[model samples]
Target: MASPLRFRRSSERWNDDRIIEELYSHLDSNLGARSVTPHYVGPDGFETRRFEMDNGDMALFTWNDDFAYWLGNTETPPALWRTSKYTFDEVPYQIARWGQRELLADLTVESPWLAKYDYLSWFFLPVLFSKDGRETSRAFFRKYDAGFPDTTRDEALSFYERFLRTGALDDYRYTMASKLGTSQYFDKNRMSSAMSEFTVAKLLTEAGYDVIPEIEVTTGHSLDFRADPRNGSHDQSSLVEVTRPQPPTQRAADTPVAALRETAETKSNGQLNEHGGGAVMFVDCSGFRDDEWSAVVGEQPDVRHRPAVVFRARPSGAIDAYKKGSVPLSLSQAVEWV
Candidate 1:
């Protein structure tokens, strides 16, 4: 699959006239490309050119004598686009810096709706502006409150913006942000499920673990996180898999407790069962309202799996949580341990 944003490093010497001609020819033919003034000026010593097509596809070529870089969402060019892809942070500072400015300009240059959620726009820039997801992702934030029910769009944006500003998930920006997806239509379930991972990351960080996401294990699947405890003597990694129960109104389980149990049981039967053992299950009830959460927390229903955390978080930075089985990590920082 073509990457949402492509960043490539080329060592074939673009400073030479012959190479430059070949590059332009390939882009012009494949992408119906025409050069325009780059919206953002790159660092000194870098020559930058921006291209646009009738379809709105864009490609940026920037290079200095020592390094040549390509950042674009256009169709794959001949040999250059086939080169390895680099994440936004993997490229050299100058190129990455320019890419941020250039890409952000490309993303927000015309979309006035995005202006208010500056932090969210920047945090999810890769996916929010991706070729396939640009419309749907933005719509989710703009119209759907990013799937947070009973909340205004601005409130939802503020909740996420505040958390993202903490920079806790900066290391996994691409993987995590892309999880919000680029599908043609907005899916509340899928988008909210993706955001659940971010909530789990926040919980894990507050609980004092060095949180690493998308951890690979013996099972073919990738677990959501591997958090190392920072306690004075112990050094064991804990794998956490997160699942979010649909709000009671959205699911057949009309009661909050039933919804939480049914949702967690499905996960226990599927991915967690496949994971075999030694992983913690986190059932997030953040989508629930005061009464729904009151019911679930009041009952403290068992999620069918031990070593599980059942929690609800408010946008106000409040968390009510209960654990089943012997949960190994300390979570007193943010969770009230309800």
Candidate 2:
């Protein structure tokens, strides 16, 4: 696998002209799948560039203030892909730094020959940031777009299944969220649920819990995850069910906060009852009233097994594991479970 050329901010003196030459030279040499050419270097000191990807689609970027912001596709309107930026000091193109590490492994398994150019992450960045990022990405890379090029729904599923056979779960997640910008599959409520689950899953993984998504327990019941505690070995595994109250936009103009809490509780109760155990329920309290949230958290789930503790996921990503809990855990705290 080829390693993408990495750039970092350094105190070393930089020759602007020489640096631009090296960058363009590197792209031309490394990008075997794409034709990279210098578009123009503006007098204002920003360098504009264009890339024609493997599938013949083109995108543009400009390097300014040590950051590269994608302009847009060759012919597409700016209305689709918002201007997304990448800094030279950080891993380029990826929304999260952790993704860079995973990307290397993905490239090894999927396209080892392309590994050399993986560092040219910008080659893939624009499409992923656009409204139809996923679609454009798939099209540009010659991957099967879910519903395009006259492919039927069944054929699309087959392509999806094949891809899922090797694609990482996190990739699926990132891709799904990107695709949701234009997908019909996720409406308001479903999008809320998806976001809550994704947030909790990310936090759990950060906290060193071996978390699995949508682990099925019974015939019709699937919990969000069957999580192993911080330590690799644990006597008992935990089933975690996550839910979020109505999003701010979805709430009725006249709906009281109490009604929203009730709605959240109902969803939590269903999971607790079906799971019938000490499964922990994580409720996202993003838009719930303060008093309503307190009341909801104060009440416990009544189940045949032991009662469950309801944790509130605050708007700022902090976790209130329980009412009056002393030790609050940050999303990235993975050393030990709080």
Per-candidate TM-scores read 0.88, 0.41
lDDT of each: 0.80, 0.43
How many clashes (backbone atoms < 3 Å, residues ≥3 apart in a chain or on different chains) does model 1 have? 0
- lDDT, candidate 1, 1-338, per-residue tens: 23456488887667647444766667777767787888878778888877787677777888777767877766656768557888888887778878887767766666656656677777787786576777778777787776666777777778778888878788878888888987767687888899888888878777777788999888799999998875653357799999999988998998999999999999998888988978999999888888899898788989988899999877767778999999888788869988
Off by over 4 Å in 2: 1-189, 202-208, 232-234, 247-257, 265-278, 289-307, 315-317, 323-338
Clashes of each: 0, 3
Cα distance off (Å), candidate 1, residue 83: 2.3
Off by over 4 Å in 1: 15-33, 79-81, 112-119, 231-236
Model 2 C-alpha RMSD to native: 16.7
lDDT of 2 by residue, 24-93 (tens): 3444444423435543333255444555544433444445555544332233322223433333234344
Worst 10 residues of 2 by lDDT: 1-10
